[model samples]
Target: MGALFDHLIAVPILLPLLAGALMVIVDDRRRPFKIAVNLVSTLTLLIVAITLLMIAGGMTASGDPARTSVYLLGNWPAPFAITLVLDRLSALMLVLTSVLAVAALIFSLARWHRAGPHFHTLFQFLLVGINGAFLTGDLFNLFVFFEVMLAASYGLVLHGSGTARVRAGLHYIAINLSASLLFLIGVALIYGVTGTLNMADLAARVGDASAENRVILEAGAAILGIAFLVKSGMWPLGFWLPTAYTAAAAPVAAIFAIMSKVGVYVVLRLSLLVFGPEAGDSAGFGAHWILVGGMVTIGFGMIGVLASQGLSRIAGYSVLVSSGTLLAVIGYGTAPVISGALYYLVSSTLTISAFFLLIELVERARDAGADVLAVTMEAFGEDEAEDAEEEVGVTIPFTLAVLGASFAGIALLLAGLPPLSGFLAKFAMIHGMFNPTGLGDGLPIGAGTWVLVALLIVSGLAALIAMTRSGISIFWASIERTVPSVRVIEVLPVLGLLGLCLAMTLQGGAVIRYMDETAASLSEPAGYIESVLTAERVARAPSGTPDPAQGADEETEVAP
Candidate 1:
C-alpha cells in the first residue's frame, strides 16, 4: 500500500493523457462511450486530486514528514530525471483544476459537447497539460506542458464554428504562437547558462550565478516574462483575452478562467523561489515592472468592465482584474499579503467562472441583435423613452429568479462587497500591506500602497455599478422576456462553483490559514528543493527474490 500510494501522484497527469488519447481513438460518433470515458476520467481525477490535496496539506493517513512529495518517472534520479512534485501550491492547483473540470464537463454534457467532435478528448488533453504544468518539477517540462495546454485551448476556443469564434481563435493562436517561440528561446538561454533545467537546481544556482551568467539569465527571464505577461492579460498584451473568452463556448470559457492564472502561478513560483532576496545582486529583478504592469492592468480591466455592454466581456474583464490583483499582491512581497491574494484568487476565479457559465443561459432569451444594443444602451445612459415593445410583469419565473440571484451573487463576489469572501480577502491584504513586519527595517506604506488600496476600492465600485446596470437591463428592462430553457446540467455547474465561493466565505478562517501556510511554504522552498533534489528513498530488495526487502524494519521514508 505504501509503495503503491507513493506512485499515485503520477496518475493526475497520466490518467488524463491516456484517457484523452483513448477517447480520440474512439470514433467521434460514439457519443455515449466518449461521455462515459470523460465522466469516469474526471471523477477519478477529482477523487485523486482531493486525496493528494489532503496529503500535501499534511493530512495523510499515515506518515506526513514533509509537505512536498516528489515522484520520479521511470525510477530516475533527481536533477538528472523527469520529476513531478506535489507541494501545497501544486496540490491546491490540481484540486482546483479537477473541481472545475468536473463541473465544466458535466455542464458541457447539456449541449456544448455536441457542438463538435472530440470535445471530450480536447478537454482531457487540456487537463493533462494543466496537471502536468502544476506537478512538473523542471523548467523544460513546464514549457512542454504549457504548449500542450495552449494547443488544446486553441482547439477548444474554436470549438463552436462561427465567424467571431474563428476570428478570435486565430488572433489568440497567433499571439500565443509568438509567445511560445519566445518561451522556447528563454528556456534555451536559461539551459545554456545554468546547465540544468530542473527548477530546484535553477533556484539553487541562480542566486550565486556568475556575473556573465546572470546577465544572460536575466535576458532570458525578460523574454520569458513577456510570454507570461501575454498569458496573464496584463494591459496591452492582453486585449485578446476578452475577445477569445467571450467567443468561446460557455464551458470552455469557464475552464479558461483558470488558464490565465497558469501564468500567474509560474510567475509567483519563479519570482519568489529563484529571484528572491536570496539571489544576491539579482534579487527582486523585474519586481518593479510586475508591480507597475499589474496596476496598469487593473486600471485597464476596470475601464473595460465599465465600458463593456455584454455580460461575457464583463466577465472577461473581471478575470483581468483578478489576475492584476493577484500579480500586484505578489509584487508586495509579504507572506500574509500572498495568503490573502491566494484567497482572492480562489474567490474571484470561482465567481468569474460561474458568471461565464451563467451568461449564455441568461442571454439565451434575448434578441440576438439586441446584444450589441444592450451593451450600447447600458454603457451610455441613452435618453430614450421606454420601448413600446417593452413588457413589464409583476410575476417572477423560476429561471429569471435563478439568473437574478446568481447575478447578484456574482456582483457581490467580484465587487468585493461585505459579507463575502471577496471582501475578506481584500481586507486581509490591506491589513498586511499596511503592516509589513520583518523586512529587516520597516518599509513605509508608500504611494503605490495607497494607490493599490484606492484601486481595489474603485474597481469594486466600478464592478458594482457595471453589474447593477447590466442586471437591471438583463432582468428588468426586458423588452421580450423568454423563460430560458434551463437544464439541470447547466445550472448545477454554476451553482457548484458559486457554492465553493460560499464555502470559502463560510470557512474563511480555516481556508485563510491554509493559504497562509501555503504562502509560507512558497516563501521557503527548502522542503520542495530537498524533496526534488534528494533521491526518493524506496524499499530496497535483496539480490534474489524481491519480497518487502530482507531486513526492512521500518518503512522506507520518502516524501509524503
Candidate 2:
C-alpha cells in the first residue's frame, strides 16, 4: 500500500498527460467518450491528491520525519535529473487544483465544452501543467510546466469565440509572451551565476556565492519576480486581466481563479526557500518591494471592484485582491502570518471560483437587452424612476431562490462577513499580523502591519458594496426579467464549491493546524533541501529477479 501510494505521487501529472493524449487521438465528434475519460482521470486525480495530502501532513503511516517524497525521473539522482516533490505545500496545491478541476469539468458539461474544438484535450493538458508546476523540484521544469499551462490557457481563453474573446486573447498572448521571455532570461542569468537550476541545490549554494555573482543573482531573481508578479495580476502588469477574465467561458474563468495564484505560489515558495534568513547577505532580499507592490495591488483591486459594472469584472478584480493579500502576508515573513494567509488563500480561492461560476447563472436570469440598458443608463447618468406599483406578493422560483442565496453567500464570503470561512480567514490573518511572534511576546507593531490591516478592512468593504449593488441590480431592480432555465448539472458544481467553503468554516481548527505545520516547514527549508539533495534512486534487481532483501512491491520506494 505504501509503495502504491509512493508511485501515485507522480499520477497527478502523468494521468492527465496520458488522458489528454488519448483524447487527442479520439475524434472531436466523440466528445462524450472524451468527456468520460477526462472525468475519470480527474476523479482519480482527486483521490490521489487527497492521499498525498494525508501523507504530507503525517496523517498516514509514513513516519518519515521530513514528510517529503522526492520522485527522481528515470531513476536518476537529484540535482542531475528531473524530479517531482510531494510535500505539505505541493500536496495542498494539488488538492486545490483537482477539486477546482472537478467542479469546472462538471460545470462545462452544461455546454461550454461544445464552444470549442479540443476543449477536453486542452483542459486535461492544462491540468498537467498546473500539477507539474506545483510538484516540480527544479527551475527548468517549472518553466516547462508554466509554458504548457499558458499554451492550454490561450486556447481555453479563446474557447467561446466572440469579438471580445478574440481581442482579449491577443492582448493576453502578447503580454504572457513577454513574461515568458523574461522568465527565460532570468533563468539563464541565475544558472550562469549559480551553475545550478535545481531549486534545492540552488538554495544550498546561494548563501556561499561570491559578491559579484550575488549581484547578478539578485538581478536575475528580480527579473524573474517581475514575470511572476505579472501573472499574479499585480497593479501595472495586470491591466489585461479583467478584460480577459470577463471574456472567458464560465468554467474557464472559474478555473482561472487559481491561475493567478500560480504566481503567488512560486513567489512564496522561492522567496522562503531560496532567499530565506539563511541566505546571509541576501536574507530578506526583495521582500520590501513585494510588500509595497502587494499593498498597491490591493488598492488597485479595491478601486477596480468598485468601478466594475459587470459581475465578471468584479470577480476578476477580486482575484487581484486575493493575490495582493497573500503576497502582502507572504512579504511580512512570519510563520503565523503565512499560516493564516494559507487559510485565506484556500477560502478566497473557493469563494471567488464559486462566484465566477455563479455569475453565469445569475446573468442567465436577466434579459440581455435589460442588461445592456442598465449599463447604458448608468453610464450616461440617466436616472430612471422606480415602479410605484402596490406591493404584490411574488413567489420566487426554486432556481432563482437557490441562485440568489448562493450569490448572497458568495458576497458574504468575499466581503469577509462573519460565520463564513472568508471572515475567519481574514480574521486569522489580522490576528497573525498583530501577533507576529506570538500573543505572549511583547512586540511593537510596525507601520506596514497597520497598513496591511487597514487595506484588508477597506478591501472587504469595497467588495461588499460592489456585490450588493450588482445583486440588487440583477435580483431586485430587474424584476421583469425571466428566471433562467438551469440544469442540475450546472448548479451542482457551484453548490459544491460553496459547500467546501462552509466545510472550511466548520473545520477551521484542523485547517489552521495544517496550515501552521506547512508554514513551519516552509520557514525552515533546510529539511526540504536535505530531502531533495539526498534522495536516492531506486535499486534495480539483477537477472530479472527481485533481491531477497528488497520486497518485490517496494523496489520503487525511496531507500532509507
Candidate 3:
C-alpha cells in the first residue's frame, strides 16, 4: 500500500502530458469535450498535489516528517539517471501551481477558450512544463521543462490574436529565448566542471572541486542565476513584463503570475542547496548581489505601481514587488525570515491572481479608453462642475456591488491591511527581520533590515492608493456606463480565489506552522542530500516467481 503511494509524485507530470496529447487529437470543433478533458485533468492534478504535499510535510503515516522522497526513472541510481524529488518546498509549489491552474482554466472556459483553436491543449501542456519543472531533480530536465512551459505560454499569450497581444508576445518570446540560451550554456558549463548535471550530485561535489574548476563552476552558476533572475522579473531584465502582462488575456495574465516565481523558486532552491554553509569557499556566494538587486527591484516595482495608469499594469508591477520581497528575504540568510517570506509569497500570489480576474470584470462595465479619458480630463482641467441638484440616493447594481466588494477585498490584501492574510504575512516577515536570531538574542537590527521594512510599508501604501483610484474611476465616476453582463462562471472564480485568501487568514496559525517547518527543512540541506544520494531501487524477485505483494505469476519489485 505504501509502495503504491510512492509513485504519486510522478503522476503530476505524466497525467498532464498524456491529457495534453489526447487534447491535441480531439477535434477543435468539439470544444465542450476538450474543456471537460482539461477540467478533469486539472482537478485531478490538484488532488494529487495536495496529497503529495501531505506526504512531503509528513501528515500521513506513510511519510517521514524529516525525510525527502526521491524517485528514480527506470529504477536507476542517483547521479546516473533522471530523478524527481518531493520535499516540503517542491510539494508546496506543486499545490500552488495546481490551484492557480484550476482557477485560470475555469475562468478561460467562459469566453477566452474560444479565442484560439488550441487553447485547451496549450493550457494542458503548460501544466506539463510547470509541474515537471517543480518535480524534476536534474538541471538538464529543468531546462527542458522551462522550454516546454515557455512554448505553451507563447501560444497562450497570442491566443486572442490582437495587435497588442502580438507585439507583446513577440517581445516576451524574444527575451525568454535569449534566457533559454543562457540556461543551456550554464547547464553545459556546470556539467563540464562537475561531470554531473543532477542537482543533488552537484551539491555534494561542488565544494570538492579543484580551484580552477570551482571558478568555472561559480561562473556557470552565475550564468544560470541570471536566466532565473530575468524570469523572476528583476528590475532591468523585467522591462518587458508590464507590457506583456497588460496585453495578455485576463486568464493568461492570472496564470502568468506564477511564471515569475519559477525563477525565484530555482534561485531559492539552488542558493541554499548548492552554495550553502556546507559549500566551503563558495558558501554564501552572490548573497550580497541578490540582496541589493532585490531592494532595487522593490523600489522600482513600487515606483512602477505609482506611475502606471491601467489596472493590468499595476497588477504586473505587483508581481515584481512580490518577487523582490521574496528574493530579499531569501538572501537575508535566516530560516525565520524565509518562513515569513514563504507565507508572504502564497498570500501575495493569491491576491495578485484574484486582482487580475477582478480587473477584467470591472473593465467590462466601462468603455474602451475610459482610463485614458479620465486621466486626460484630470490633467487638462476639462471637467466642469455640475449645478447642485436635489440630493438623490443612488442604488448600486448587484454585479457592480459585487465587483466593488471584491475590489475592496483585493485592495485590503494588497495593502496588507488587518484581518486578512496579507497583513499577517507582512507582520510576520517584519517580525522575523527584527528578531533575526530569535527573541532576546540581542542582535542589532541592521540598516538593510530597516530599509526592507520601509519598502514593504511604502509598497503597500502605493498599492492602496492605486487600487483606490482605479476602483473609483470604474465604479463611481462612471455610473452612467452600462453594467456588464458578467456571467456566474466568471465571477465565481474571482470570488473563489478571494475566499482562499480569507481562509488563509482564518487558518493563519496552521499555515504559518507549515511554512515554518518548510523553512527549517530548506535551511538544512544535509537531509535532502542524504535522501537523494542514498535512495535505493526496488529489489526484484527471481524470474517467474509470483511475489506476495503482486499476488500474480509475474515478477514484482518490492521496496525494502
RMSD of each: 4.5, 4.3, 4.5
lDDT of 2 by residue, 195-221 (tens): 788999888888998999999999999
Can you give the lDDT of residue 319 in candidate 3?
Answer: 91
Model 1 scores worst on lDDT over the 10 consecutive residues at 551-560
Clashes of each: 1, 0, 0
At residue 165, candidate 1 shows an lDDT of 96
- Which segments of candidate 3 are over 4 A away from where they belong? 59-66, 380-391, 439-444, 541-560
Q: Is candidate 2 or 3 superior in TM-score? A: 3
Error of 2 at 222 (Å): 0.8
Across 1-560, the per-residue lDDT of candidate 3 in tens digits comes to 17877788899999999999998998999999999999999999999999998888875455447478899886667756589999999999999999999989888888999988899999989998988998899899999999999999999988897899999999999999999999999998998888888888888888888899889999999999999999998878888888898899999998888889899999999998999878989988888789888888999999999888888889999999999988888788787788888999889998898888888888876777888877776678653446224224667889989988999999999999999999999999898888787521222588998998999999999999988888777887663467888989899989998999999999999999999888888878899888887887778568897534343223222121
What does the lDDT read for residue 80 in candidate 3? 63
For model 1, how does the per-residue alpha-carbon lDDT over 193-228 read when each residue is reduced to its tens digit? 888888887887788789988999999988888898
Go through the candidates in order and give each one's C-alpha lDDT.
Answer: 0.86, 0.89, 0.87
Error at 115, model 1, angstroms: 0.6
Among these predictions, the greatest lDDT belongs to 2
TM-score of each: 0.93, 0.94, 0.94
